[model samples]
Target chain A: MRGADILRFSVHALKGYPVRSVLMLVAMAIGVAAVVLLTALGEGARRYVTGQFASLGSHLLIILPGRSETTGAHPPILGETPRDLTLDDAFALLRSARIRRVAPVALGSAPASWGRRERETTVIGSTADFQRIRHLKLAQGRFLPEIDPRKAAAVCVLGAAVRAELFGPEAALGRWVRLGDRRFRVVGVLAPQGQSIGLDLDEVAIVPVASAQALFDSPSLFRVLAEARSREDLSRAAADSRDIIRDRHEGEEDVTVITQDAVIATLDRIFGALTLTVAGIAGVSLVVAGILIMNVMLVAISERREEIGLLKALGAASGKIQLLFLAEAGLLSLTGALLGLGLGLLGVWAGRELYPALSLAPPAWATAGALAVGVGAGVLFGVLPARRAARLDPVQALSGR
Target chain B: MIRLQAIQRKFVVGDQTVYALNGVSLEVEHGEYLSIMGPSGSGKSTLLNIIGLLDHPTSGQYWLAGKDVTGLADEERAEIRREKIGFVFQLFHLVARLTAAGNVELPLTLAGLPRPEREERVRELLAAYGLTARARHLPGQLSGGERQRVAIARATVTRPEILLADEPTGNLDRSSGREIIELLESLNRQGLTLLLVTHDPQLGRRAARQVQMRDGRISGDGRGG
Candidate 1:
């Protein structure tokens, strides 16, 4: 039994029944393609969501006003509402720990303009530290400068989209934009930050906190945007800020200190579950493909009964007979897996181009896993037919026409 | 080289027991040519099949080369047949898809001989059987006599100690039959034990010895000389 001989015989056997061989190969291809497509999708979704979270500034934390419930009653009534985060609490957090800089942020919707072009935009009001805290970059001019207390300089950084639409290719920097009744000078134009999960970062307008508060007729307190000296001290610095804010508000627990890492972990859980759910749904096709393989193999065995008998009469061992059929199954599946892997990689590449936000890249492990799954199905589903062929009685088989 | 003591072969058909060979005793020595003559149901083919190790008797002691082969496994029996016995059939039993040379090389291939050696042996056997020119012809392309010659060449390529043929000449014309008998006799003269089954008494008498079987039992045995 030369390997060449077995291979040659396999080719001959397959050629003897072209339609059946093609059908078997089709079944194997479906199985391998399903496994590759589903697993790749799972990996792509995870990367997409993770990238979105990373762009949102992983060092920042969100603080909402509430006393988070730690205990519950049998007949639950509403929990206590804590005092709001005020200007004093923001100032107190600024002094706590080794925090390097802080910007009191205030968010409001305002109709903005730069001479005859106006659009309703979300206004983020903060100080110079807001630029470093949110990783904002300037396309032109400069960001707001650090100002003295109670100083209200009317300057703004126009987002890329707002600048393009309002100024129509003109230099937006050093121009004046009206926010509500007051006019603010365009100190800078922020670079284009593409959409993250459908929220267009390029559509926003940033202004100084004092100017925004005075123009909107708001209170002095703000949504504090803080930055640490280093990312390593983020957890400790966040806890210290919470303590200070808690103390200034008379331990009222009004603010929620949630780190970007915490939010990312939550997002990972949601995306991970979604990927698994889709993969599980696609797994049904693989199982159906396996069953089809078994059925086709059984049919092949029945059709080749006489050939097997002739080989047996020539003194071929039972193990050799089993090996031949198993080889057929393996060859069919291996070819299918290779084709499916190439198809899957091409699909991932195409998907990445179609949706750059998805950022699809098929990992090496995915290719290897798909190949293993294909060969394993071949062996597993091939066993029954191989055994049946091996066990056929030569006397009766030879007698069959 | 071959002996059977009180061989009994039975088959059950619809709850009725049929005896293919019952209480049959025979012997064939090296270089001896013998023929078994009987009707279709007289167990002639059954006895030949038993001697070739293609079929087993229900109750019998079969000795080949002085070893009791009655208890041998199927693989062991096949090995013995490959090494020590050759078989020819009435229909030639040539693998229809194979060329004359390929059919001749089947035994050598089954014996796991190297490809070059097997091909060389097939060439020699085909030349010896006067089929060298038709070696590339498939069984379908060759005449009945040529096909039988290829089958005989295939059977004898391993240089077996015994040749068991069932009606080797029944399907051939007289001239072809005579040629096959001459070939078998020449090989017999070279010390191969030959047991041939035939319905023609004239063909049976050509052997050195003859045995007659009627109704699953040996009816007569005598020296043709």
Candidate 2:
């Protein structure tokens, strides 16, 4: 038959049984929508994490005190002890040509009391260059002075939230706040920078590294933050920092140095795999939809046996009969896929509105994949029913046996 | 022209081989109006099905228009059926979903005629069948006589050389049955070959030639008025 006529006939058949057609369409549509929405969520999470890490600053590297793994495959008889990374090791990293700045970190929690207002909060101890290296901005006064490394100067910077709590909207600069047993003058108030990488920047207090070491009564530093001069120098800066620390610790190499690119790359790999897995799980629903189409088409064949017989008696070839049935399946699935595309996009839009921080958009591949699978499922699942219709005995069918 | 030689069709019914058509040979010239009449289980319908190429005889040699068609492939038979034959059934068998015009246009559509020509032919055929006003009406909404007329229009839409009908008036009322019989007779008189199968002796006797079947074989063959 003419292609147009075939399409018209199939459309007429579907319209004849609106409920059944809608059922199949809904099954296929839900399957496609599931794939799209779930993949959007997975990809949104990936983007969120990538954006979080991006805000930490570019060409950055972090140095931790302990190695995550031992050198040899054999288990350490006494759990290989790690050497402490101190301020001296942090100063030594500045000697590398590729390293632009290094800030030794000492972290501890202490209660700060200003008159009657007292709140317990985390204290981050680093050098004056920490402001530039970590991309911190001052709202009032100046950051800690570039002072002698060995001198213990009592000066502090209050985060936006900490300033608000202790000073109560009044000027927080030049105020003395007692932290634990030590009293430090607040030299600066940080700008209102929100949370990043799980650390609430607004609630923390920044102090000079020597004063924090004395306040916390600890000799070892928590970590060291370093910035490379350029993107190309990041790897070299990381290697040089590790080597410098290893040499200062008498060749122990106990410190772990991680570049920002490496961390972002690892996160990307993890999230990429997660997105694929989520999409694959959603693909199972498509298979279920395909099976539904098969079941419905089988029922259609049985119900339309007399119609098939009539067509055959009207000189329709077996191939034509098969084609007509397959056309019906294809039309249903294609329509369903289109409906699902709209639904998935609507879902993504709703999610974005509810959580503005997340970049939730359906990927192009997901849309294309959904469409391909939809039509392919219809045609593949249609084979058996179409063949059955084609193979029907016209005499028996006409006799309604 | 059509010819069937020693046509044999057997049915295996629970270890009993029932002969539906046994070594039945028949020939029909172009434009000849013929009818086959028999009681139930006498294989009149079976003979019609074989002649109409809806069923294959187990062992037979059949020729149509001087071409051997017994061993023809399914698609080739379908092509011949499309071009050279049309069928009318007792149930009218109009596709319930299709409009009257759509039903009449089916064979032309199947033959891949262009839309304009197919529509034109359908309009002409519907007007000829006195169903032009009901062109958009579905079979369910059509009367018995109207449905049969639509079926006849569908059957001859491709201008087939022969029309095979089985119990064409079996489901119609007396007046509708008379109208259908007269229509078939008029088509036969217009030099279109007609082969009808029926059990009604009155309708059977109206054909130009009659063949009587009993026990899977032809018992009598003679010319009528």
Candidate 3:
């Protein structure tokens, strides 16, 4: 028989038992929906984390202290320790044309006291470009003034929690706060914000590089944050920054330069594996659905014993009969897959509405794979039942013996 | 035309072998109308199944329309059945979901006839069988006589040379059964070879030739009834 005819006949057969058909459909639908919704969730987590990294600026590079103990590098001898990253080294990154902006950061913990209210807070010392490079916004007043790196301008920016603790809603932008016996006037208050990586921006105190270096009594800078002219310039700028910093440190390539894209790529790889893993877990349910189809088809063989006998007597080849049975299974699973896709997309939409921050949607491969597994499982499981039906003894089947 | 020479069909029941057809031999000519009548367990139905190629004889030589069909494979036998044989069963055996027209067109559909040709054939058969108005009615909705008529229409729609009827009227009322018998006889008169297997002596006697079976073998053969 033609494929269309076989489909028509199988559809008629399925329609004869509505409850059975719908039961298999529901089972298959749930299996596919699990794959779609779960993979979307997995993929959403990946995008969210990568998005956090992207917010830090895709073109930014962090120059940290000390060389990583990578193979084929000059061994770190006891007396030849990697030098501290100084303010001069941070400034030298600007020597490269590929480098756009640089921020020299120095971190230290200090007790800040204003009139009797005392709090321990982290002090971040950096240049004026730190505001743009770190994407920090000011809630009130302006950030530190642009000045020479050697000038010890005693000005500070308080985080939201620090502002609330010391100022208590009062006007304190021009007031002087004492940090480690050094008094500095408040220049800005950072807006309340979530933590970035490990830094709690809402509780940090920002000050000038020279003032922080003097207050901490350390000549070493924490890390150098630099931006490339564009995303394409990041690699060259890193190489150039390494070369320029090495020239300053007496030809020692002692610092580790980490690009934002590398971190994002690593995170993306982890989350992509996570998405596929979750999809693999959900794929188990598809096989269960296929078993349901096979079970129901086995039952159908008995129930339609007379019909099968009639078809055999009517001269349908065994292959055609098997095809008819497989067609029914394929139809059931295909319909269920489509229904599950709609249901899953609706779920993904609802998830987006509930958590607007996460970008929730099914991955293309998961969508295709879920559909393939659903249908493939149905057809594969159908083989045994279809073969059983095809090989039925026509005489016995007709006699119902 | 059909010929069976020393056909033997054996059944193994646990520790014993029961012969369903013990070396029965029969010959049927083209356009012949014949019936095999016997009591239950007389192997008449088994004989009919072997002749229809639905069951294989354990040891036999058979010829159908002058072609040796005994050694044909399952697929080739099915091809022959599709091309040259039609069947009418006791229960009508219509797919309940199909309308009368759909049931009648099943043979042509299995034959893979094009839609226009198949539909025309179904329409003509339905009209001839006086089932034109009931074409869209399901088997459950039709009367017993109408359903049996529909079954006959399905059987002959493919225009096969041989028609095998296994108690085709057994499930119908006497009046409907009589109508069905008349219908089969009319097709037989139109040069289609008909083979009927039945328990009804009256129906069996209506055929031009009649055979009786006992103990898995033909006990009587008579004509001119």
Candidate 4:
């Protein structure tokens, strides 16, 4: 048949029973929607995770004590754990030509006070490089400097939430604060940096590394946080940092030199499995939808038996009859796919709008796969009914006695 | 021209085999007006279906235009039916969805004629059959005679060499039946072979030749008019 004739015939066939055609399209739409939603969920989760990592700082890398501790052979967050990294390792990496900037960090929970207000807050001790490496926005005075490292100046940077809680409607910068009986000057207040890994960045205090070491009274450096010049040199920079730390530890090979790429890969592996699990469950629903489509097509064939016979008697070839029914199935599925895609995208947009934390985008592969699957589903479900219609004996059909 | 030799058609009723047409031999010449008369079980319609190439005999040599159509496949038989013959049935078999003009235009459409020419031919044929006034009416809206006229127009629209009618008047009143038969005979006079099937002898006698069947076999063949 000519394309126009086939289209006309298919349209007539669909219009012949409006309710049935709508029902078929709805069934297909549901299947397509399921696929779209599933893909969006996986994509949304991935985006959320990646966004969190990027917010922490894209150029960042963390230098932990060792692979043995991170690999779960020992308690990583325990206070009794010994540090294989030292201040010398931090200095060497900072002096390296391939590296951008490095900061020595000493993290410990302590009681810090601003004026008459006192609250338990996480105290992070680092030099000026910490602000750039960790993407901190200064809401007030400047961050601590590397030049004043050994001066033991009583300077503290208050987080936004801490500033709000301690000194409402009052300037926090250049104010005197106390850290566990030690007097400090508050020189900066960071902008509101919301929760990362369930802990709010703006609820903490930043202090000089010398003051942190003095308060902790520890000779060992906990960890070194470093940033690379660019992503291209990340592996080489990581390897160089590892060699410096290993050499400082007398070739102990006890320190873990991890890069952003490594963490990103690990995060992807963890969530890729999760996304696959979701998709597999959704795949079951699709199979059920496929079965529903097949059953419906079969019913359609039986209902239109006389019409098929009439068409046959009208000199319609068996192939034409088969193609007509197949086209019906394909058209139904394609409509469903497009509608599902629209609904899925709308859902993603709505999710992003409603919940900024859940960042959502429709995955490229899933969108394309949904359409391809819909066409495949149409053919799969259509073939049996088309064959049944095509193979019907015109004589018996006409007689229908 | 159509011919049948030793045509046999059988059906299974439980375990018993019932022959609808058994060892039936018949011949119809070009432009011949013939009627097949029989009781319901005597295979008049079966014979018509076989002769129209709508059915294959269980065993026999059936020829249309000197070709042994019994040997032809279903698709080949359909091709011959499309090109050489047209059928009018007791039900009129006008596509319910199509208008009178569309019903008449179907065979031409199947023949792949251009749209303008198909429309022109359809209009001319509907006008010839006195259906121009009802050209846009559906089959359900037309009178029995008008419906039969539309059926005849549709059948003859392709200008087939032969026109076959199976109880074309069966659903119509006596006057409508007479008008349908007259219309068919006029087409026959115009050199289209006409074959009619009916149980009513009065209707059968109007044809130039009548063949009577009993128990799936032809019992008598005689001049009708």
- By summed lDDT, the worst window of 10 consecutive residues in model 2 chain B runs over B122-131
Kindly list the interface RMSD, in angstroms, of each predicted candidate in the order they appear. Answer: 2.9, 0.8, 0.9, 1.9
Better-scoring candidate (lDDT), 1 or 4? 4
- In model 4, residue pairs whose N, Cα or C atoms come closer than 3 Å (at least 3 residues apart or on different chains), thus clashing, are A154-A185
* Model 1 RMSD vs true structure: 5.2
Task: Write one digit per residue (lDDT tens) for candidate 1, span A202-226.
Answer: 9878887777778777754435656
Highest-lDDT candidate: 3
Q: After superposition, how far is residue A31 of candidate 3 from its true place, in Å?
A: 3.0
Using TM-score, rank the candidates from best to worst: 2, 4, 3, 1
Q: Write the per-residue lDDT of candidate 3 for residues A31-119, one digit (tens) a residue.
A: 99999999999999998878887898988988877787331121222233568999888988999999999999999999998998999
lDDT of each: 0.76, 0.88, 0.90, 0.79
Cα shift from native, residue A173, model 3 (Å): 4.0
By DockQ, highest first, what's the ranking? 2, 3, 4, 1
Ranking by lDDT: 3, 2, 4, 1
Clashing pairs in 1: none
Pick the winner on DockQ between candidates 1 and 2: 2
Deviating ranges (above 4 Å) for candidate 1: A2-8, A55-58, A62-91, A102-120, A148-154, A174-185, A209-225, A252-256, A260-290, A349-359, B6-24, B31-56, B85-110, B122-159, B162-225
State iRMS for model 4: 1.9
